[model samples]
Target: MLNFPLWKKLMVGVVLVWSVLAALPNVLTPAQMENMPSFMPSKTINLGLDLQGGAHLVLQVDMETALKQSYEKMEDDVRAALRDRSSGTRINYRGLRSNTETGIHFTVLNPADVPTVKEKLHSALTGVFVLNEGTNIAVAYTPEELTKMRKHALEQTLEILRMRVDEFGVSEPLIQRQGDDRVIIELPGVTDVSRAKDIIGRTAQLTFHLVDESARAGHRLPAGTGVFYELIKDEAGTVLDKVPYFLVKRPALTGENLNNASSAFDQYGNPVVSITFDSRGTRKFGDMTKENVGRRMAIVLDGNVYSAPVLREPILGGKAQISGNFTVTEANDLSTVLRAGALPAPISIIEERTVGPSLGADSIEAGRIAVVYGFIAVLILMAIFYGGFGMAANVALLFNVALILSVMTFLGATLTLPGIAGIVLTIGMAVDANVLIFERIREETQRGLSPMLAIDTGFRSAFLTILDANITTLIAAVVMFGMGSGPIKGFALTLSVGILASMFTAILVTRWQILAWLMRARPKTLKA
Candidate 1:
């Protein structure tokens, strides 16, 4: 075990050097890291929300809205499917209506049309179960279908939130589904709570609807139409006034048809969002523009009209631009939301808390003080207990610390208060390995074995014991990481990394130091 091969020596040297360099960024300021060369590693361990202090939001997904929207869409499909004249027999229905909780209800005018409509309803909705109540037929989602849809909605909502947060450039944001209909978001170092909430909460549903010029303001919208108030903002984003536009309930093209959206400048150097549509959207948009060549089309986002450009000619390219009175940031954010796609349903923040940087600074300082004092204490004790062997262990312990930081930085792991506690625990465990080895060596020395022989036998004997203990601890860390969340996960991560590093340093690195010492001094007696 004491015989270090050339490759092992080289590996140890390389790892030590690399770890120190990789861990350097963590100790440096943001300005210092930026000043570093591009090729050099400037990435540091990302601090968790607990350590950095940022936005904490608990959002509840509007599942009712999702279910209602689904029912409404199913209603439209049922109408389309039952209205087909190709079946030779006309299927008549009246009093067609959909309720949020009760689903879709429609009565067949003729009892003979019931069987035909039921078939069409089944064909129209994939997961719906249809029930016949004499002349009245009710369509609702099956239990299994509802469960699946709710799960999908939650998953899709999480993904959309992640994309939006990623576009916002949050350093280490945590976006995950909580319960069946809740989402938890943590934005580290995000001080602007209002902006973060605005960006995350906005549905950003963009649709192109034709402007109804005949409809007068203040008059209630007629059936088959809806009113969307367009905001008029001054230089600031605050709404000065709102002008209502009555339009057809159906949109000509929605953002769902968009393939991509990017922020760009218009011909006049004003910021705009350029969008590309998918094939189906291309056909629909092309036909719409061709048919409505002299009409104005309103570009609406979340029921607010950004622009209502007059359709001059057919847009066959599937590409269009949205120009409006927008700042660069606004344009970029809009493009981000468009590209990310709309959330499955609206999300309302049920719980919100803002963590201040002062608390983060205090936490960081406390963590720093604990680590420094604990490390120093460990170093002092290790050097004093086993003398020369203790000094060797101290060297390995230092490398272990550096290796932990390097691994965390490379993996982009978040560091929290519990993570620091894990490191301190690792410091003790690392020394424990050395203590076992040194005690074994002392026993070998008492047996009158030569210093080099005693060292080799001690390490070989201690190897299996060290491996067994560390491996078991490593397994625990793995389980912790897999099962835990947030701070517990952070703790597990650092603990796991520290265990591996400690094993390497204790078994390989410290042995190399002792072997080199033995070879150079040719000691006749062991010192422990």
Candidate 2:
């Protein structure tokens, strides 16, 4: 009744065989797969964290500090932009320099030099901080006017975190910004989770400060501040080099200015990081290089200097390349950091989870035991009761398993401990459609029909019942999927796919096989 073309049959068989062969590598030991060619398809099921020995962490990024840093940067920008226009007038911030209700009210001095001071104020504040020329000019900012400026620092910090994640090279990584100021990172298979934590945990924020030219020649750093530099040591542990505390000299150089950064070979064919900056950044950078031609400008992050080089001349053209004593990996990582920009906030690992390989093995064993026994009992009962039809049902059951694996592999889905239980449940349900079909066939034969006709009748009548039962089960599985988190989702996914595959194999494939048998024998009486 449902004969397939010879070519179609060959194609189907080939697909099934190739899929199994392709997947075989995944099922084999890692060492075996490694020995095989890279083009070979992997067959092994990807284990979830519960099965794989790995780490899980829930981190909280500090947004408040990020906000303060952003505000401070704006404050500094305003000061310097104004100071650069100095006719050198003395001014003091009056009480309540800013009240920031409907607008920002910054009270300042220089009553006599109103026009010149207003010109300087106009350069930095612009439309946001308008002046009211009185005994002391009061500048006020409009509501929500500085929102974009406020978010700059935090946004930069978040960008840096994304770059760091890329550097770690974890597959199928999940890094996302959580509520307001937090970030969530889920690495499925990680060996050294603590190392990752250490790298990301560092704020890596860099700042530049001029020598405080107003202070005395022999002046020491103020109480709150101290000079910092990289304390590099040789084998004897002697201080071999020092890079300074500043990330960049004087004016701020935000990571946002960077357009492209990549690792490539220099003229000597050594690894180097090439960088390109935006128009505005190129000008600022050129000015900085032009001034500090002989001094070492520190390339610092999280208080440690990565490099400090003396400028030979102004690095113009908005383009430059950094060549350092680094391997290819190091150069690439630095380039990635430059590419990701910066984070919006400082992030710290607050909670961590590490599942040992031993524990994972135990979990797998326990799951396997539960699934094996659960299906074995049901399979045994089916064979004892239904004879030939029962064997057909077992075939369908195997098909269900194959299809489930195929679907999972196609999706690149992870298998968890609960997911194994779902498979076992599927094995039991695989027989349900067969049982219904065979029982209906028995009833049709009792109604005075020949064996072939009765078998046909059984399938037609029982199809609806099989569909209804599977659909109901599917609904339940969907509900479970909704309720579950990571592991639960795995189980629900497997169960749902198994149910669909079971319907096709049990109702259609087995029905067609039985029809072929009935056509050949042309029996007068039904076997059941």
Candidate 3:
């Protein structure tokens, strides 16, 4: 321990210098950071909602509606699969509809057609159960399948929501599942609450359907056909009027084929959203447009018609645009949702909260005072007990704090009030390692061992104890971080990082400092 190699000393010096450099930007103002050279590290620790006020939202996903929609789509697929003329099996079906409680129900025209229809549906639907009840057939999903689907929908919803929030430029937003069908979103530094909510809540389900001109008037349609109204709103978003459009119940194209979307201005300076499709969508769209030239194609979003433009020619490039009377913000939001993809299910805001900047300021100030006081208290106590050795421990403790902050900044971890408390706790624990080593050294010296021998034995003996203690605590911190949410997770993160940093500073850094002091002074009898 007394003799330090040249490379080891250089390694220690390099780490401390790099940590300080990485942590330097946190103390600088925005203008100062901007003015600094690009080579310098400019990353800073992200502040949580408690430290920087913003919006807090609790959302509940409507799984029932999602299940209903899934069944309805499945009903359409079943009808189409059964009506395939190339299958060689002739079957007739009618009254195809989905019941919320009974799944998809339809009537077979003949009893003998039931077996073929069932076989066809089984081939079409991979993971669903098909049953025949009297003359009616039902396509049902098992509980396990439904549960799996719901779980997937929740995970997909979280990803899409995260993408949307990130595109909105809300840095370090906390979005996590709270319960079976609920999510919590904390957006720090968001000022436009209404716009944020609107973006989060919109489903953005875009579809293309053909207009049913034959069902205009004096014509009776099929059982499931109905009219959908598209509302016209004023600048204030008040419903001024509504236009009714009759469309086939099934859509020719859906948002699932979307590849990209962006907001742009038309030649007339009106905002619109331009969209592009993937390869398969391109083929489908090209075929549809090629056959439907001179006919109207409805551009519908979330059951509302945006436009019904005549297909002048084949759009082979798979690109289209939706033009509506929209402001720049509305168009931007629409594009954002389209790019993020539609949510599998709708979400409703169950709770909303806003924290003021003044409160955040107050909390930050209080936390700073607490950390300063706790640090000073530890420094003074160590100095009084261990004399010159305490000064070395103080240096290590300071570096330990810097290392913690540098790692957090680099990882983009959010710092909350509980995180501050964890740092304060770390200050106390950091000195404990030094105290153990110093006490062991004093005991060795009392036994008439030389300073060099005592120092070596002390470090060697205390190493296992420190490792065991810190390792156990680190494990606990890891568990807490994995299982906890929000502030608890923040606290666990700081504690885990602090434990690792303290192990480095207390054992290696302070040991190097003491060895350097002994080599320079060459003290025969050490007081510390």
Candidate 4:
């Protein structure tokens, strides 16, 4: 155990140098890091939400709106099924409508076509039950199917929220489902709460519809049409007025066909959003514009019309731009949401909290003081009890702390208050292995063995005990990390890394130093 080869010494030297270099960035300022040499380590540990202060939000998903939209889509499918000419027969229908409570309802105009209509609808739609009383029919989702839909919607919303948060460049965000209908989000280092909320909460549902030029605002809207308003905003984004437009109820295209979106500037130096569509959307948009060359097309997002430009010529390149006199920030936000994809359901913020940086600063200071005091006490105790060997243990303990910080920086782990507590505990535990080995060596020396033989026998005997103890603690840390929440996870992560580092420094490093000293001094008597 005391044999130290040239390769082993080189390996230890490299690890010590690399760890110190990596941990150096934690004490340097951002300006100093920027001026650092090109070949040095520069990454630092990330701070948790509690340590850095940020935004906390609880959002509730609007399941009712999601169900209503699902029903409306089913209603359109029913109409298309009845109008299908593949069978060389069209079923006449009337009073076709849909609601969340009643599902889709319609009546066949002719009693003879009731059977044909039911057959066509049953074959066209899946996961739905069709029922009829005489010529009147009702279609609704099965209970099992409804449950699956709700679960899928919630899961999809959670994934989309994660993507949006990632694009926002948050360092260590915590996002998870809270209950059946709510989500909890914590964004670390986010100061602009309003902007974060806007990016997260907006549904960003985009649709395209044709304008009804013949209908006026004061008159009744024509059949198969709906009234939508466009909000006119001032320079500061305050709503100035709303212009109402009559648009076709059925959309020509939706955002599901979008390929990419980005913020850009128009020819007049105004901010805009440029969007590209997939092949399917390109074909549909080209056909719609070609068929209605002289009409106006309205671009709607989240139920409000953003732009309604006249189709003077057909657009066939699968690209379009939306000009809404938006500020640069607004345009960028719109582009981000478009690229992230729309939420399956609308979300409303039910709870919100903003943490200030002052509280974070105070917490950090308190943690630093605790670590320093704990470290100093450990150093004093070890030095007074074991003398030279204790001082060597102290040196190893210092490297152990550096190794912990370097590993965390490399893994991009976030440090919280609980993590600091873990480090303090590690400081006390780091010396336990050295104390055991020293006492074993003293026992062997008292039995009349020589200093070098006593040292080797002590290390060999104590190795198994140290390995067993550290392995059990490491297992507990793994369990905590697997089963605990965000804060507990922070604690477990630091504790686990600290245990591994302590094992290396306490067993390998201290042993190497002691053997090197014995070779130089050639002591006749052992004091440890």
All-Cα superposition RMSD per candidate: 3.2, 6.2, 2.6, 3.1
**C-alpha RMSD in Å of predicted model 4 compared with the true structure:** 3.1
Please give the ranking of all candidate structures by TM-score, highest first, separated by commas.
3, 1, 4, 2
TM-score of each: 0.89, 0.72, 0.91, 0.88
lDDT of 1 by residue, 438-472 (tens): 99999999999999889989999999999999999
> lDDT value for candidate 1?
0.89
Which stretches of candidate 4 lie above 4 Å from their native place? 4-7, 30-37, 107-115, 131-138, 142-148, 172-184, 214-221, 265-269, 442-454, 522-524
lDDT of 2 by residue, 1-528 (tens): 344466855664664565566557645798887888877776567788877667776677665555455444555555565456356765454442333342333455656656665677677765466556474555544446455544554455556766777776776555655555556666767887766676566554443333322333346655334455676755444778874452223334655577888899989988887878888879987887788776655555555554566667778887766654656865776676657655556667777888888898899889878866886777678788987777777766665677777778878788888888888888878888888889988898888888877777888888889899999989988998887656677889989988987887786667756766766776678765
Q: What's the distance in Å from true for residue 259, model 2?
A: 5.8
What candidate 2 gets wrong by more than 4 Å, as runs, is: 1-23, 28-43, 76-105, 108-163, 176-182, 206-250, 259-283, 294-296, 304-312, 316-339, 368-375, 446-449, 475-484
Model 4, range 1-528, lDDT digits (tens) per residue?
889899988998888888999999997998998898989998889988778899989999999899999998998899899999787777888899898987999889899988888898899999999999999999999999889888888999999999899889987798988768889898988989999999999999999999988888778888989999999999988999999989998898899999999999999999999999999999988898899998999999999999999999999998999888899999999999999999999999999988878888888999999999999999999999989998999999999999999999999999998999999999888899998999999899999999999999999999999999999999999999988877898999999999999999999889989999999999999874
| Candidate 1: segments with Cα more than 4 A from true spot | 28-40, 211-222, 232-241, 260-279, 293-296, 305-328, 446-453
State which candidate, 1 or 4, has the greater lDDT: 4
Distance from true position, residue 518, model 1, in Å?
Answer: 3.2
lDDT per residue (tens digit) for residues 101-170 in model 3: 7899899989988888888889889779999987799988988998898998899899999999998999
RMSD score of candidate 2 (Å): 6.2
Looking at candidate 4, the ten consecutive residues that score lowest on lDDT are 85-94
